[model samples]
Each structure stands twice: as C-alpha cells, then as structure tokens.
Target chain A: MITIRIPTPLRSMTGGKSEIEGKGASIGELIEQMNADHPGLKDRLCDEQGEIRRFINVYLNEEDIRFLTGKDTPVKDGDEVSIVPAIAGGAHD
Target chain B: MFIIPSDIWEDMIDHARGHAPRECCGMLAGTDNRVTRQYRITNILAKLNEAELARFDQPKLSDLKQLAPEERADIAFQMDARELSQAQKDIRQRGIELQAFYHSHTMSPARPSATDITLAMEFEHCRAALNLPQPLHVIVSLEDRDHPVMRAYRIEASRATEVPVRRQ
Candidate 1:
C-alpha cells in the first residue's frame, strides 16, 4: 500500500479526505487501483492516452515523477504520492 | 467574490508593474474567499525544457520557442513548477487554503481571453479541486499602463463570469 496525499481541489472526490492509502506495484497501477477505490480519480489524473496530464503534477515523495519515469515509475508500499495542479500557458491541452 | 486586503492588493499590482511586458504569476493563500498571504513566484514563461513538451504538443509552445527570450514571456506565463509545488506544501503547513491563482495580462484586458479561459477551464476540470464551487482566477491587466485594472473571475465549464474583487 502507498500513501497518497490528495490536494484540496480533488478532496471532494475523496470524500474530503486529504490523505488515503491504496495498493499498486507501480505509479500507473497505483492510480488504477486507487481509482477503483475512489472512482473518477484516475480519469482526473490520467488522460485517454493513459498519460498523466501535463497540467497535473504527480510527485513520488518529494520529487516530481516526470523528472523520473512518469507514470511508469515503480512504487512500493509506504511510498508517498502527492498530486497537485500545474498551470500552463499557450493553447489548451 | 474575493476579498483582498489593501496591502496584498497593492502588492499584486506592484508585482505586475515590476514585471511589465512580461506576465507575472503567483498564488493567493487565505481562508474562505478572502486573501491573506500572496506568494510571488518566478515566472518560467520562456524557460520551458524539452521534457515538459511532447513533440510540439501545442502550437503556441512551439512558436514560443521561436521568439527571443525577452519577447517570449509576453506571449504567456507559467510559474516555476518546483517552486509552486514547494509553495503548496508551505501554504498547507500554515493551515491556510490556497484561495486563488493570479497573473498579469500585460497586453489584454483584465477579462480572460480564449486561451486564459481555456486555461481556467482546464483548471476547473479538477472537479472543484479548490473545494470551491468555481476556481477563482484573478487577473491584473496592465493594458492601460498608467491605470492597471484588476478583476476576479469564476471559471468553470469554459465559462468565465466576472466576480467582484474587493480591496478591503
């Protein structure tokens, strides 16, 4: 199980809880399993291509997973995952 | 509606003025719909790295790379990602909510443009991510230069409705 820190914006979807625990072997699986438990979460975080939307930042512990392996980044029990909104410019995504 | 203290309101204007043609972006943290603390973040408008882009994903981004760095910031603004993430953690630690996101419109009106509207709507899709019925985006327009105008907006579902910004 991994500990995921939910941002305030996504809190309503999580029943207003700021943090929750879920299961997954990698960051990708974790989002799927967590979405199974939370519902609609994976959709908010992942796009149709199964890629983490560029406007959404996912951090594994203190480092943004983008700088690492992105959604493919492996995860294990007790790891911390934090999701926050990223604002971008130019035409919409 | 968003209530901003006088000092913070002035600071936002000053931040916009200081940046001039370049857009200035930051976050506002507070309780309820009133602002208490303002964070001035470094705008990485023209500092995007290749990792952040995927194959000329957005035409504007690709076009942005064509402009001279100084002229680049004028077309758009994006806050430094690491700084924003760190700021969120700090804001949470202080027990205050991040009430709104703010930026300057150096050449346009205080109202959101199509791209700004799209940006806000993209943010809106977070599903009440801010725990507010609509996410608030405050824009300061330096179009007049001599008289900077600021306005508040509630952006959702591709719509941007003007909300009063009171300087208390």
Candidate 2:
C-alpha cells in the first residue's frame, strides 16, 4: 500500500484525511486509483491538457517526481507520496 | 518607474518572516512609478537539499570581510536570468512593468546582499534603453518598521536615490 499525502486545499476531497493509502505500482496508477476513489480529485491534480499543474509538486519519499520518471515513476508497498502546492500571502511589517 | 504599495510590501515582509531561515522570492509590478501588484514567485527554501545546505556559506563570515564597501555593493546587483525571466513574464502579462525584484534577507540585515546587487547589474545589462528615466533597483530591509529602509538606484551609473514607498 502506498500512502498519499493530501495538501490542505485538496483535503476536503479526501474527507480531510492528511494521508490516504492506495494500491499502485507507479505514480500514474496511484493517481488513477485516487481519482477512482475520490471522484473529483483528478481534475484538480491535472490541468485541462491532462498535464500536472505547474504550481503543484508531487514527491515520492521526499524526491520530486518530476526529476524521477515523472508519471511513470515506480512505487512500491509502504512508499510515501507527498503533494505540496505553492503557497502565497503574508510579509513582515 | 513603478511604486510598490505599502500593503503589498507589508505582505511581502510577512511572507519573508514566515519563511525565516531561507529566502523568499517574488515579483513587484506597477506602471509609471507605482507598483499595483505583487506575485510570490517561488520559495527557495523548498528547493534546498541537505547537500546544498551543507555547502552553504554565511554571508556575514565570508570573503566579503576583506572586500571594500564599494566593491561589495557592486556585487549585489547580479541575479540569475531564468529567475529574472520568470519575474518579467509574470509582470508583463498583467500589463505591469517589471519594476524591481524583491527577496527577504532573513537572519541578516535587510540591506541588499552581494547576490541581490549582482542580479540588479545583470538586469540593467540585459534590458535595453539605459537612458530610460526610472529607478531599476529597489532594496527593502524589514529590520525596523518605523524606519524600514527602501533604497532605489539605477544600475548603469550606480547612483542612489531615496524614494518614499508607502506600505499599507
């Protein structure tokens, strides 16, 4: 089972669970499984062109998936996936 | 010339403080001496790895200790092209001129660092119209709110000017 960490903005879709477990041999499969389970998360994860959005980053065990094999990056049981979106706002006075 | 609003400047300072220990980068935008918009570009903190941090040199204790003040100031205007391009494009698309690049100097004086000066110099070299009438370099140090220093300068002649930038 691969554990997928959900970001704050998308947590509502996952019923507020910070992390969810799924079965997949690769990043693509993991996302596909997530979409099947969550129903509306796929659209948020991928843009209209089906490409990953520029502001969102996905990491497999702290390593950016983009630097890996991208969507084809392999995953195994007990692997951890983290999703982080760039945050904006706030400055010191 | 673009002017950054006080509120936005405050927001940027807050963002910088929140990301303390690492630098925060963003774009400043405005038209004709006023900055109406600001975009948080990226968090450099998110990109650093253990190996990179291990090799990090503290600016306060670096070879800068042996350099003349003028030489040290000159080094602050250089910046990376890719980062400049990203900032420029973001501002341009919004119909705002690329006024200045702003970043926080966490754990250090709010003054422009050697890296900042290098970026400013690079920007002046790559951009056309050196004769354009506007201040291209802006440095804001959030150390003291009452007298938060905002210095403006032209990168070509290396002349400094003091301008009042109101933060809301």
Candidate 3:
C-alpha cells in the first residue's frame, strides 16, 4: 500500500482523511484504487483525457510526478504520494 | 464575516498596488475563522510559454493564448504552481487552513466577476462533493488606483453572496 496525502481541498472526497492507503504499481493505478474507495476523486485531479489537470499538482515522494513519468510513475509499498491544487484565478473575461 | 487586521489588509492593498496593471493574488490562512496570515502568489502569466498556454482548458485562460504576453497579465493571473504548493504546506504546518483565495481586479469592481464566479463554482463543486467548507473568494478592485476596494463572497451553487468584510 502506498501512502497518499490528500490536500485540504480534496479531502472532502476522502472523507476528510488526509492520508489514504492505496495499492498500485504506479500513480495511475493508485488513483484508480483511490477513486474506487472515494468516487469522483479523479475528476478533480485529472482531466477528461486522463492527464493530470493543469490546476492540480501531484508529487511522488516530494518530487513532482511531472519530473518523473507523470501518472505512470512507479510506486511501491510505503511510497508517499501527494495532491496539491494550484491556487489560481483572475478577473479575465 | 471576515475580519482582516490593518496589517494584512494593508499588505493586500500594497500587493495589489505594487503589481499595478498586472493582478496580484494570494491566500488567506487562519484558524477558527480568524485570519492570521496572507501568502502572496506570483502570477506566472508572463512565464507561460505557448505549449503551457495551450494546455489551459479554462475558456478565459485558453482565450489568452491569442494575446501578447504583456497584455495577458492585465486581465488574468495564473499562480506559480510551486509557490501555491509551498504556501499550502506552510499554512498547514502553521496549524491553519487556507480560508480564502484572493486576487486583484485591475479594471473591475471588488466583486466576483463572471470569470471569477465560474471558477469559484468549480471549486465550490469540489468543496461540496466532499462536504468541506467552501473557502471565501476575495477580490480587491484597483479600478480607482487611489481608493482600492476589497470585498469577499461565498460562492455557492453558481451564485455569489457578498459577505461582510471589516478592517480591524
């Protein structure tokens, strides 16, 4: 089981659980496991194309998964995965 | 109701002023509804390259890819992801939660504009989906350079209800 830390914004879906255990060989599968336990969690973190949303950042063991293989980044028991939403907006039309 | 002390209040104003035509943004963090600190986030508009811009699915942001880099910041702000992640961590470590997300409206009123409302609703959806408290959306209108106005709102169900704001 991989240790996944949920951000405050995304915790509601996790039943307010900050840390959740997921079983997967990669970040992609981990998300599947998590979404199974907490439905709709994937929509907020990923887009329709299954790519990580631009507004959300995922880190694998303190290193951004983007620096790794993104959703395919390998994970193992005891690995740490975290989600952080990008705080962004504006007054644009 | 949101009560902002004079110091943080002034800092927000100063941050908006300092950025001028370019909007400034930040987060308000606090414990027990009492705001304690503000984290200013850099707008990474100017740093966004074509490839990155194309990835923004938000209509308002995607629409900006046509505009010149200098002109884009005038109407929009996209926070630096690294800064945003760090701010959230720091606030958590400080034993407080991020209570509000704020940004300057360089040419509009200190109210949630259409774009702001739309985005706020998306966040509201996430908040509601998990039954979490929805954070406030604070806007500082710098339309009148000298007398900037700040306001806060609770965006729910696609509607924005103005919340009382006070400077302590």
Candidate 4:
C-alpha cells in the first residue's frame, strides 16, 4: 500500500482526509486506485489529455516524479506520495 | 515611485528568456523604484536529467521540486540581508528595501502559477521578519516574446491582492 498525502486546497475531494492508502505497484496504478476510491480527484490532478497538471506537483518520498520515471515509476509498499498545490500571495515591486 | 527602469526590465527580460525549457528562480532588490540588485536563486534544470523526466512519478516530481517553505523564507531573508548590507555600505545609497522577488515560468503564463502563489505565501513570512512595509512578488512569463507580462501581488490580511506597477 502506498500513502497519498492530499493538500489542504483539495481536501474537500478526499472527504477531508489528508492521507489515503492505495494498492498499486506503480505511481500510475496508485493514482488510478485513488480515483476509484475518490472520484473527481483525477480530473483535478490530470489534464483532459491525461497529463499531470503543470501547476500541481506530485512528490514520492521527497523525490519529484517529473525528474524520476514519471507515472510509470514503480512504487514499493510503504512509499509516501504528497500532492501540493501551487498558490500565490504577497507583494511585488 | 515603484517605477522599473528600462535597463533593469531589459535585464529581467533577458534573464527570464535565458532560463527557458524549465524554470528560473531569482531575487530583486531596489530602493524606492530603482532596482540595484538581482540574483538567481535556483535552476530547476540542474536537478533534472533527461532520464529522470521520462520515468518519474508525479508525487516524486512534486516532492523533488518542492522547495521547503522555511527554506524559501530563508533564501528571501538572506537575499534581503545582502541587499540591506550593501545599502548600509553605500554612503550615497538610498534606503533600499528588498522590494520584490522575481521568478520565471518557461511554459506557463505570466500570471502567478499555483506554485507561484504557494511561494508567495511563504515569502510573506520572510518579508515580515525583515519588517518590510510591503512585500512584492513578481512572476515573469517567458512563453511569448511579444506578449511577455509581469504580474505583482501582495499578501494582505492572509489574502493575495494584485499590486499595479508602471511597465517601463
């Protein structure tokens, strides 16, 4: 089982559960399993073309998936996945 | 007057353009309206190789790209301090504050991306630590040459608001 950590902005989709467990041997399967349990989240995280949203970032055990093996990257049991939304605030000159 | 000089704008444009294909990170410093300092904070390209991009998981990518909130704050603070130190040393120097931070989006729009927003929120704490009256966050879109736009925002009352700047 892989652990998925949801960000605060998307918590409503997960029933307010920050972390979830999924059964998958790879990252892609894990996301599929998560979508099966929590519908509507896949749309938010992936584009219509099935690509990960450019703005949203996914991390597996502190390593960025983009720099690793992408969605096909294999995941071992007990791996932790975190979803972080990019939000902006503050002043500029 | 928060007016950006044309030369500085040119420099910023060049810097943003140079870091295309991935993303560029940098700092902006100035007193009042005249910018006197700029520094590159990070280059995401350095962290990613061609092999990693082909086979990484989204979660792993997110985690690797994740700049810790505190670490970001520290970078801003350190940049601010360096600017302050230089300001103090310049007898003719005007009291320049670390006015804003500048970063670029290679394939994204000039408007703040989700990551930009998150980083801006983190930067607010750094600005507060320096007692800055205003903290500015700037995002540069390098996707188009003719339509490049820079957006500025401020965190006030725990919310982000647009702050207007006269384009040079």
Among these predicted structures, which one has the highest lDDT? Answer: 3
Interface RMSD of each: 6.6, 15.3, 5.8, 13.4
List, residue by residue over A26-69, the lDDT tens digit for candidate 3. Answer: 99999998999999888777767898766567877666687678
Instruction: For candidate 4, give the lDDT of residue B36.
Output: 68
Instruction: Give fnat (model 1).
Output: 0.24
Q: Score the docking of each candidate (DockQ).
A: 0.18, 0.02, 0.25, 0.06
Q: Candidate 3's C-alpha lDDT? A: 0.78
B66-165: candidate 3 lDDT, tens digit per residue: 7899888778777766676677678767878878889999998898777677656645543433323468989999999889999999888778899998
In candidate 4, what are the lDDT values of residues B66-149, reduced to their tens digit? 544332221111122223223323412445556666766555565554444555554343333234446476667665766777
Candidate order (lDDT) = 3, 1, 4, 2
Candidate 3, superposed: residue stretches over 4 Å from native: A1-24, A28-55, A59-85, B50-63, B127-133
lDDT of each: 0.75, 0.55, 0.78, 0.56
Model 4 docking tier (incorrect/acceptable/medium/high): incorrect
Q: What is the TM-score of chain B alone in each candidate?
A: 0.86, 0.61, 0.88, 0.64
Residue-level lDDT of model 2, residues B60-164, one tens digit each, is 224333445333221222122234345555665677676655665543454444434433443343233222123355555545544445555444443334445
- Scored by lDDT, model 4 comes in at 0.56
Give stretches of model 1 more than 4 Å off: A1-56, A60-85, A90-93, B50-59, B62-66, B127-134
On DockQ, the leading prediction is: 3
Query: For model 4 chain A, where is the 10-residue window of minimal lDDT?
Result: A84-93
Pairs that collide, model 1 = A9-B129, A9-B130
lDDT digits (tens) for residues A1-93 of candidate 2? 988887655778999887899988889889899999999787777656665555556767756677678889999998988775432211221
